[model samples]
Target: MAGFHLPLYRTNLIRSSSSPAPSAYTKPTVVTQNLSYWNSIYSDIESHLKKVIPIRDPVSIFEPMHHLTFAPPRTTAPALCVAACEAVGGNREDAIVAASAIHLMHATIYTHDHLLLTDRVGREPESEIPHRFGTNIELLIADGIMPFGFELLAGSAGDNSEKILKVIVEITGAIGSQEMVAGEDGGVGRPAGLLHGCGAACGAIIGGGNVEEIDRLKRFGLYVGKIQGLLSEKSKNEGCEMELLETWRALALKELEYFDSRKVEQISSIVGV
Candidate 1:
């Protein structure tokens, strides 16, 4: 797999040494710090995932697995896990391995979903994986990757056995037959909500959050998931969508009331409300 890289921090950091700085020219320390923080999280996740899913002797199988897993960093599931951990005052290192596991599960789901789309030839031609690789092999690869995700969590648990075990159980339940898979068939509403809520709750547990805090964070994730589902629905009415988004956003913020202001801001930034 190619080396991992973070998206460039957009703000320019350079300053002219000779020029007298104006009052308005305050340094973007906060933005810089935030960028650096997330960059480290992304890097850690990539490094750990690469270690768990390495390129090796089985050229065909590993190659496709690598391609799907190491594609462009489009999803925020891993970052959300890291953010949730930090929200509850856990160190990034504690959550990094679990976050990678979450990402692998996500990739597995997507790979399997894409393969299961029977009408891809007609409806999603551009989105189809290369046909040269047989569908059965792809399915097997997806199935195989799922176990490796759990293996990563188990191996990385170290001294935090109880916490990591809880995370594994939570993640497994979230992506199991009743939740994520159900969503694939019935569309997003309750399934998506449950899945994200489960993820956030697991992250909170791994991060050592109190029972109440974990519940609150789970509610926050559920609301965020609902918003996502609503937005994705083609039949959604604009007025109703806005109302639902606002309602969920408010509820999520209410849950963050007890958290530190900095942490609340970071969570809000991740939720984009």
Candidate 2:
């Protein structure tokens, strides 16, 4: 496999007693490199997202969406989507669009979550206009952003209608009221697990994986998501959180046993195992 390497140039100066020293160039040094497939995919997805969601009119709503979507520097969702696709032997390009959609979906959900929190905690003293606008307007913006995510999926689908449709269904269900929103009501369930698992499974489908492979990857995603949720819960005891994270990480690794070691390592990197 190809690796990432950086070239270092060196210049040597030779002193002459009778005249000015002449400069001599030495051979460039090359360091052994290991390329990260996930990083490459992330760069592609970032570029694609920027093009897909450019700034538009009605700056009040779109600006907030853009800020929430890009400002934080998204890494997990898009990386997982692309990694899952590659893990299942699918081209990374096949899942880039879906990855972008996944990111937008998360942004929309986060916007809604922020609005809900702001409603209870009251807006910050120096909050943006969208935050000051309160829940109703934010809701409208969320609603508007949601459809654009689907539209991106539709546009990226090209002639592969069935695969894209499956991805859409999986993602929509994961982010719907039953899963992610369930946490809003103070539920104990790990909604992040469902969301990540669903995203991986959808990416697997997009990558043309067989049913068995997709199922395995979905389980892997579930465990990874569970870890994420546990880590995010500040109220949870640190000892218990570490225990659960280890358990889930083990389970996630088990699911990827059939894949190549390199691929497994890449997935492990994403899961932070």
Candidate 3:
């Protein structure tokens, strides 16, 4: 199997299937190397995002789009995408578009969540949660990026054209499904679960996994996401017992047992992050 790697050169939103993307990889032999591996993935994602959501005309619109996408602490959705792909013995490039799309959409969802919070908070400052730009402008930026996600995702799939099409369907349905619509009313608890499940499934599919492999990884993501949800006070207030975090964590690791040691090791690290 190919070792985990990150593509070095910049790639456009769209790439021809005939041309293979270039990457460099080394065996994961030390903790520092592991950190470097993850760091490289984050850097590559940010670099691609710069190209994807560039500073363009209409600064009012593009500026916040850039801020929303790039400014805050990065989320794990994009990392999960790339990690899942590599865990399944696929190139990181196979998952870049879907990864970026997941991050953009998730960021917008956070924007929506923040807007709802501000409505109730009534101009008062909140302690946590990265809030920036005016609520109105944030909403407009969210709307602007919503459709851009589709454009960025559609037809931008690499060699995994058919698989990426399937990923698009998975993502589109996941984002609009009842869970997501209801998730809007609450915190990221439910929505993050959906994102994790969808992110893992899309990565596996694009990585050329078979039905069973994809299903295993999807289940893996769901359990990990539940752990994330349970970590938040909002989700705990919603009746998730803190004890269940261990249970979910155990269940998540159990799912990894279905795969070989290397895949399980890498995936477990991703979930840990």
Candidate 4:
């Protein structure tokens, strides 16, 4: 749910293509009818996720109690993407596969994030987080979970292994210092936005798209990050200093509004609405 994305329209990010204008949004086309293909990919993603994630204590790693409001809205995003793709005559199979992979990737990232924090705060020694030599569980949970996320994304995405590996290498390398510096310096500044953008860039690649695809993915990623920021702040309000709460809320809303606006713009372009 954190943000980092590439622009679909940003040619510099990828080798440009003169591929025919993407099929009309209303054209009746099944780019791929292999429902089985989608299902198989879903199974592959899910199985890999299970292996990496600590399923036994899902809340600690999955949807931890701290992120209640984020779950529903975040879950809706990919569904919206699927519908948008269907309207655009894009293959539902590919769309679903992308959605499944993206969502799984998000979850995987979140799980590692939690582990990193717990380890940081010394809340969960087994987490093996480098910092937080001696802190409480609450403190550990308070931190963001993005670093572990990219690692999992790179290691697990087996379908388009080569492309996934490249994206992982790039995203992971860029995000690492950003995360550590922000954490140590108390500068969670723009984390959600930065994360959202990365998500867009990386997700587009995983979905077999070029720069134009990345643009759409970036907007989508920003929206997700904003939503997460809002909900996470809401969940952490009681524990946060009163002065910080409003600041966090403001950041969340700002991120949300920015993405919401972008979502409209991108969807209009995609659907020719």
**Model 4's lDDT to the true fold?**
0.40
CA-lDDT, candidates in order? 0.65, 0.66, 0.66, 0.40
* Tens-place lDDT digits, model 4, residues 1-273: 111122212111112222324323222211212223223433443444345444355565444423411221233233333433433334444444444444543443444445444225533464443333233443344343344444555455567577667566535542455454455655442255444445445545555555555555555545544444543454434232434434543443342343345433333221111
Model 1 ranges off by over 4 Å: 1-40, 116-132, 180-190, 232-240
Q: What is the lDDT of residue 211 in candidate 3?
A: 87
- Per-residue lDDT tens digits of candidate 1, residues 56-83? 7687878878766765334455766777
> Which regions of candidate 3 deviate over 4 angstroms?
1-34, 116-132, 181-190, 234-242
Sort order, lDDT high to low: 3, 2, 1, 4
Q: Write the per-residue lDDT of candidate 2 for residues 171-206, one digit (tens) a residue.
A: 878877656344465553325667678778888899
lDDT of 4 at 260: 41
Candidate 4: residue 197 lDDT (0-100): 47
Candidate 2: worst-modelled 10 consecutive residues by lDDT: 8-17
Q: Which regions in candidate 2 have their CA more than 4 angstroms from the true location?
A: 1-37, 58-61, 71-75, 116-134, 180-190, 234-240
Can you write out model 3's per-residue Cα lDDT over 1-273, one digit (the tens) per residue? 123322211111112212334323322112111434555677777788898888898887888999887654455556767878888888897688888888887777767666745345433354355566777888888887877887788768656568868887877766774654443445433355777778888888888888887888888877766666554433224443545755776787787787887775766764442
- Rank order (by TM-score, best first): 3, 1, 2, 4
Q: Assess the local accuracy of residue 25 in candidate 2 as a C-alpha lDDT between 0 and 100.
A: 36
